[model samples]
Target: MAIDFVRSLRGHPVRPPASGIARRTSFWQRMHVDPWLLGMLLVLMCSGLAVLYSASGENVHVVTAQAIRFGVAWAVMLVLAQFSPATLMRWALPAYLAGLVMLVAVEILGDVGMGAQRWLVIPGVVRFQPSEMMKIAMPMMVAAWLSRHELPPNWRALAGCALLIALPVGLIARQPDLGTSLLVAAAAVFVILLAGLSWRFIGVMVALAGAALPLLWMNMHNYQRQRVLTFLDPESDPLGAGWNIIQSTTAIGSGGVWGKGWLEGTQSQLEFLPERHTDFIVAVLGEEFGLVGMLAFLLLYLLIVARGLWLAGAAQDTFGRLLGGGIMLTFFIYVFVNIGMVSGILPVVGVPLPLVSYGGTSSVTLMAGFGILMAVNAHRRLLPR
Candidate 1:
């Protein structure tokens, strides 16, 4: 067979000869799996395991719980990516409605934490953050809605989508969960940008946002206002309002070129770093793993975000592209804000580091977004081809 193929090729104008084997490759199989994402996730899990051991000293339960959550989240990511974007679109409305109802339920009868109602706790299981669901659902809902509508949509449709995003964002903000609220807002902005809103319109909205800042400021709680002021100058109140920021900055600086070694971080071990296993987990990774580990972790995130962007750009349909872009960009915000706040470059807004922070709700939600991205990539060549 080989000799015959070579002979056949010799008489042709240099055409490539086909192999005898029949390969079966699905779109799913062809997609770039983003190993960097997978690697980063594993690194995060391992780092979490190490940090939680110290952060939750004398209580091994945190690490065990986080391990289970990580397994569940990975499973969810795999399952989500297996579906196509069209299927996701079909499911988006129903999911959004269910999420909205849950949000309403959280408002009416949810657990209040730190004076904010944001979680739905069921018996014998973990409490779910409805706002997290809204982060995924709102984008899908809008993308699906806009996919079915005309381009440069009329004011009415735009208003409807804006309302869809605004309603949940407002609820989350009122939950006093400003971190998640800002995330939801950022996701919606990406969706709006993908929908092709004009630059003039975007500029006008930015101006309006600037004008509304004072009114929003007035509505903020004392602690919330203090956070902004402290962000402006964390050293001003190092012992009181600024303790967390001070500790976080100190931990990161102490790590130097390389980390203090996993589980050996003085800040994390001595318990000086607040929220060491949650909001400031990145600081733990920094102190223990050092700059090299941090760079590797960031490279993984860069790959994840880049692959997601590639999928969005390559998507055959507008909805898939926008949805893909929105999901990945939201992931970016989660990482950016968490690390920024931890390093004192930004205010502590309480956003968890995606997949790294010890929280089931955030871990699961993040994986689901990845799954959606996978679905988009799996169906890239299926449209009118």
Candidate 2:
């Protein structure tokens, strides 16, 4: 069959077959198959396995649970990426609205954990974070909405986008999960920025937001205020509110260049580091894998973000571009804030390191965001009939 086709092509100097009386379908399909991004994710997952093995050394159950989480998360990403952007667009608003309802529900009847109301329980299953859904859904909703109109040259669409971002942000904050709230808001902001909102308007918004910080500070929970103050002067409460930061910094500093080696991290092994598997997983990486490992982790993040941006830039439509760009930048926010909080450069706010931290909701959420990006990339130039 192959020889026959080649022979057929020989006539008239191999008159080439022309494209699309039927609109070539391959371009749309091509974006959905992202081996590079998927490979990076696999590497991240493997690194997570190594880090978790050390961090969860004494807690065998922790390793088991996390393995299960990673498996499920990868599966979710695979399943999600198989869908087209049209399918995702159809779900965006409904998904966002559902997430919003859940967020509101969380406020009314949430299960409190470690001084935060961030989880919802379903009988016989695990309690998961509703805000994670908001993170993904908010961006999709905003992107879908803005794609309907031209870039927000007017205030109304911009305000609508802001309102969409803010409602979930306010709800997450009310749950006292400032980290997730900030992330969710940032995801929507990424979409808004990709929507081409004016820089002058953005600056004015920033100025107004900064002006309101004092009032915001006044309304913050006592512990929340202490975290900000502690970030500025960690020494002020050495044995008190600042213990986590102080210990995290000590672990990172002591790691030196090559680190203490895997499973040999004194701070993590000796249990001096709190939340070593969750919010502060970086301490384990710093203590064991050291600076080299940290850089590797960062490089993975950089690659993922760069690829996402490239896809967004190549997208042929506003929705695909905004959606891809938004998800890409949000991933950056996750990397930045998680590492910043763990390194004690920013307040500890329970932000999980993407693909590295051990949380079912978070892992799935991050993967789903990537999956959406893959979908957008796949369908950037084509429309689904």
Q: Could you tell me every candidate's TM-score relative to the true structure?
A: 0.88, 0.90
What tens-digit string does per-residue lDDT give for candidate 2 at 88-170? 88999899989989999899988999888888999898798898898889989999989887666467788787788888899
For model 1, state the Cα shift of residue 116 in Å.
2.2
The number of residue pairs in model 2 that clash at the backbone is: 1
Query: Model 1: per-residue lDDT, tens digit, 44-123?
Result: 67866766776665358888898898899889888887788888999989998898889889889999886788889998
- How displaced is residue 326 in candidate 2, in Å? 0.7
Report lDDT (Cα) of residue 311, candidate 1. 72
- CA lDDT of every candidate: 0.81, 0.83
lDDT of 2 at 331: 88
Reference-based lDDT, residue 320, model 2:
74
